[model samples]
Target: MLKGKKIVITGASSGLGLMTAMKLVQQGARVAITGRNESKLQAAVQSVPHAGRLSTYVLDVTDAEAAAKTLDRIWREMDGVDVLVNNAGFGYFERFIDAPLEHFEQMMDTNYMGVVRCTKAVLPQMLRRGSGQIVNIASIAGKLGTPKSTGYSASKHALLGFTNALRQEMRGTGIIVSAVNPGPFESPFFQTADPGGTYVSSVQSLMMKPERVADAVVKAIVKRKAEIDLPGWAALGVKLYHLFPRLSDRIAGGMLNKK
Candidate 1:
């Protein structure tokens, strides 16, 4: 469905972002992927056939000005962006006090404002063209905050709100805004998030592969679904929590207690 489409995916140096780019390229899309690491970005495009269809830009989503400027330059080079995947973000688990304020600041900048900046960078053009796609890689953390994920969860929660609000504002326009909330996925996330390895190791059995999550994201873009929770069951739990907050809190507390 994406053949010949001009698409951009941020955070494509590794994990789900890279997997999503690979999948889209396989579907014959012209992909312009961005990352903070230029070498890794170059290496990503090295193995693909029709490599001419893929381009790389070194970007840090936290820098709104740079993100806007780069996207503008890429817009001219690519002709125009038909789809944009906002996937640049990471987090570290910490006791709210153990981590310095910078940790939370970085998370908000990369996770929430990053989406805001990128969307603004491309939205005007999309609205003028009257059609486009914006896919945000949020998490189940957005739906329900987990212990040790205070900073991470807040950022995602803010992202979810931004997405929903933007979706409403874009009503009657041809632009489609969607958020994909995935559960824990197997990736290098823990290497950065924990560095110590113990927490990641304990939860390895519960993690889904990046490729599977990427598949769901691509499908959501094609179908223009508003919100999707990976694994499906997690989505159910999120809804139930909203409907039964008090009960959910007790149940959630019990579950954490057991662990």
Candidate 2:
């Protein structure tokens, strides 16, 4: 379905971003992948199936000016951007009091503002063409504030809100705005979120694989889903939250306690 499409995926160096890029390339999409690390981005270029169809750009989404320039360059080079996957984000697991104020800034900058800047960069073209897709990779954390994720949760919640509002605003514009809210997955996410390696140990076996989430993302784009949650069961918690707030908090707390 992605044949001849030009897609840009931020944070495509490793983990879920890389996997999703690979999946799109295999399906004949021309993918421009961005990352802060040149080495990791190059490695991802080599690992995908259609190497000739892949482009790599060194982009730090936290840098608003740089992100805008890079996105503009990619769009011009590709002639147009058919899809934009805003997947660049990171998180930390820590007690709110222990997490430095800078850490919260990092979360909001990269996770929330990154999406804002990149989306703005692509808007003119998408709006002019009257056709496009913007995919925001959010998390289940956005739905329920899990323990040790105060900053991370807040950023994702903001992203989710942004995605919802953007989708509604573009309702008659022929643009697709969707958010993928995946549960904890077996990716480098935990390694980055819990650099000390203490939290990932307990739920190692339960973590879903990156490929699973990638497949879901691909499917969502094809179907033009407004929002989706991976692992199916994970969506139930979100539903429960709307039905019973206090009970939902207890449920989320219980899951975090296991980690």
Candidate 3:
């Protein structure tokens, strides 16, 4: 479905971003990837089969102005972006009190504001063309908070809210806004979390692979779905938690207490 399309993905150095880039390229999409690590980005490009169809930009999404400029330059070179995957984000598994203010600020900046910056940079072009799609890689934590993930969860929740508001504002415009909330994915995300984070190693055992999450992202883009939550059980859990707050709290409390 993505054949001949130009797609840009952030955080494409590794993990789900890299996986999605590979998949999209395999399906005949010209992919542009951005990452803070230049070497890693180059390595990722080489690892893909049709490396010729890919371009890499070294960017830190937290820097709004830089990201905007880079996006403009990329669009000029690529002729315009047909799909945008805002996949750049970080996670921290620490209690609210123990987590430094800077950590929270960084989380908000990269996870929430990064989306805002990238979306704003691309929106004018998309609106001008009257056709585009944005796929935000949010998390299940965006829907329901879990222990030791206060800042990460808050940032994701804010992102989901922003996506919803933008979707409403873009109504009648040909642009499509969608978010994908995946359950824990087996990636470097957890290992990259705050060093003093609280999540145990066993927790990582249940995570799905990056390829699994990438497939869901491709589906969302192809179908233009409004929102998606992976692992049906996780989606159901979010709804159930909302409906039974007290019980949910107790259950969550028990889970945390075990740690």
For all predicted structures, in order, the TM-scores are: 0.95, 0.96, 0.96
As a TM-score, model 1 comes out at 0.95
- Model 1 C-alpha lDDT versus the unseen true structure: 0.88
Where does candidate 2 have its weakest 10-residue lDDT segment? 250-259
lDDT of 2 at 202: 79
Give the alpha-carbon lDDT of every model: 0.88, 0.90, 0.89
| Model 3 whole-model lDDT (C-alpha atoms) | 0.89
Error of 1 at 72 (Å): 0.4
lDDT of 1 at 173: 98
Off by over 4 Å in 1: 254-259
Could you give candidate 2's per-residue lDDT for residues 99-138 as a string of tens digits?
Answer: 9999999999999999999999998789999999999999
Candidate 1 residue lDDT tens string, 1-259: 8899999999988788888888888899999999999999988888666778889999989888999999999899999999999999999888776888999999999999998899889999999999998999999988887777889989999999999999999999999999999987888777778788766666667778888899998988889899889777777888998999899988776553211
Please list all clashing residue pairs in model 1, or write none if there are none: none
> In model 1, what lDDT does residue 207 have?
74
For candidate 3, lDDT tens digit of each residue in 34-97? 9999999999988999998999999899998899999999999999999999999998787788
Error of 2 at 222 (Å): 1.1
RMSD (Å) of each candidate, 1 decimal: 1.6, 1.3, 1.6
